[model samples]
Target: MALLHRAELRPTKLELLAAWLPGRAWFGGEAGADLERVAAYRFDDPAGEVGIETLLVRAGAGPIHQVPLTYRGAPLDGAEPWLVGTCEHSVLGRRWVYDACGDPVYAAALASAILADTGQAEEYFEVDGRREGRAPSMAITVEGAHRADVPQIRSIDRVEDGDPVRIVTESVELAVVRRVGAHTDLPGSRLAGTWANQPTPLPLAYASLR
Candidate 1:
């Protein structure tokens, strides 16, 4: 289960994304344009040490973007380049947010979900001392999914259109699809599917990164 809190965050998520998104090579929108978080999804951290989330944001009237992120209590070693920014969470104190591509926890969790054919994690929120259920943002399906140990991906080699982000690691070529289109699927994709609202079997993620 993934639990949420109704607390404040310094330099809110949208604020950080506003300043960070335009600078990315994959982002085609202007940094100054208004961006809205239209949808989001989460994955469970079995150890309960990290927070994994994927956001669907729209800038102005342009295309939607998929940004997977990981939140930690401290800096991620060797992943300084992926840091989105730091924020102070009222409930969790200070947190270091990074693009999920470089965070091992996120990478593993995502791979596990895809290969296991698991959907997005169920969500709940803390209300007073009670846990209340909430609707999930989207549903995912991974075709040809098979059980396996979560793959380890250290970092991203590069980002490109029509290809999964390759891992920089040497042993395995694990790749994940980026810049998804909600209406279509990718060829050569090990895992293929879509969000709940998408009208077709959109290519949400891929299994390997290499």
Candidate 2:
């Protein structure tokens, strides 16, 4: 259970993302594009085996996007069904699975970090991906521990101009500002699988839940 610190890790999350973003349908590719990591922060897990990172990537010619990703020490067996895909780590000599939205441990930690306001020693908001004139004027705070039940956690908070939105994750609860105006809910069957196997839905579908 060796946990790799961000400082000690190479090919930083943005580097991995530069190579990985083009592969996703959500990315709007620009010719001869480059990706710069505008901001990044880590989420701590009690176990510390899995690495959780929240990153804001600025594409050379496209809008900045927040990409949350998880890195595991080893392949998660029986998780092939939930994985977005596997990429060969040139340095680690192992294939790392990319499934930021599905991993349970990562989800739980994200939810907890977003909700806790007792002044943690670690900084989770260091990664600022906001563009000029588009930055959120105010901070978004996680309301409270609504529920950590499986498949959904009902949490709400105000963002920007006091707009409230609920963040529901499998096995853990999180509350955040709904900047995208919508969120997609994963199917029930997909929600039942382990974090590594959970299915991801479009962000728009999440707004429908409200």
Candidate 3:
């Protein structure tokens, strides 16, 4: 289960993405265009240290882009290049945010979800000293068979950022689609989702054992 805090963020997630998305090679819209949040989903961290969330945002009339992010209390070592930026969480204090594709914890979770058929995490938010169930923003389907185990990912070996961000670990190779519905033919165990105006599921990411 993923706990949600009803706290304010200094630079909101959309604000951070607005400033950061245009620089990516896969971003197809203008920097000044308004970005509207389409949907989002979360993946649980078994150790419960990092926050993993993937957001779908549409810029103006352009395509919806998929951005998987990891929120950490401290900076992820050797991930300076993938850092989206920092934000002050009213409840969690300063947070170091990075692209999820560069996070080993995210890689492990994503690979396990794809290879083992584990779906998105359950969500709950705190309100008035009580825990309340929060509905998921999107629904994900995994196109892979159940597996006994997935290899542990201790570090990210390589990251090739493009239309699809390729994260290579010792035991798995993950391809995270930067633009939803753009790269559907990536050969691997797949993860697809649908939400709101998008009824048909679209490819979000895929993984293959290395």
User: Each prediction's Cα lDDT score?
Assistant: 0.72, 0.42, 0.91
lDDT of 2 by residue, 99-141 (tens): 4554666555555443343211143222356222222211223
Instruction: Give stretches of model 3 more than 4 Å off.
Output: none
- Number of backbone collisions per candidate, in order? 6, 9, 0
How large an RMSD does model 2 have?
12.1
Q: Give the residue spans of candidate 2 off by over 4 A.
A: 1-12, 81-97, 115-140, 143-210
Residue 16 displacement (Å), model 1? 0.5
Error of 3 at 97 (Å): 0.7
Error of 1 at 43 (Å): 0.7
| TM-score of every candidate relative to the true structure | 0.84, 0.52, 0.97
- CA RMSD, predictions in order: 3.1, 12.1, 1.1
Off by over 4 Å in 1: 148-163, 168-172, 182-197
lDDT string for model 1 (75-189, tens) is: 9888888899999999999999998877777766766676665667889998888999998667666776466554555454443333355544432344555556743444323
Candidate 2, after superposition: displacement of residue 117 in Å? 4.4
Considering only N, C-alpha and C atoms within 3 Å, which residue pairs clash in candidate 3? none
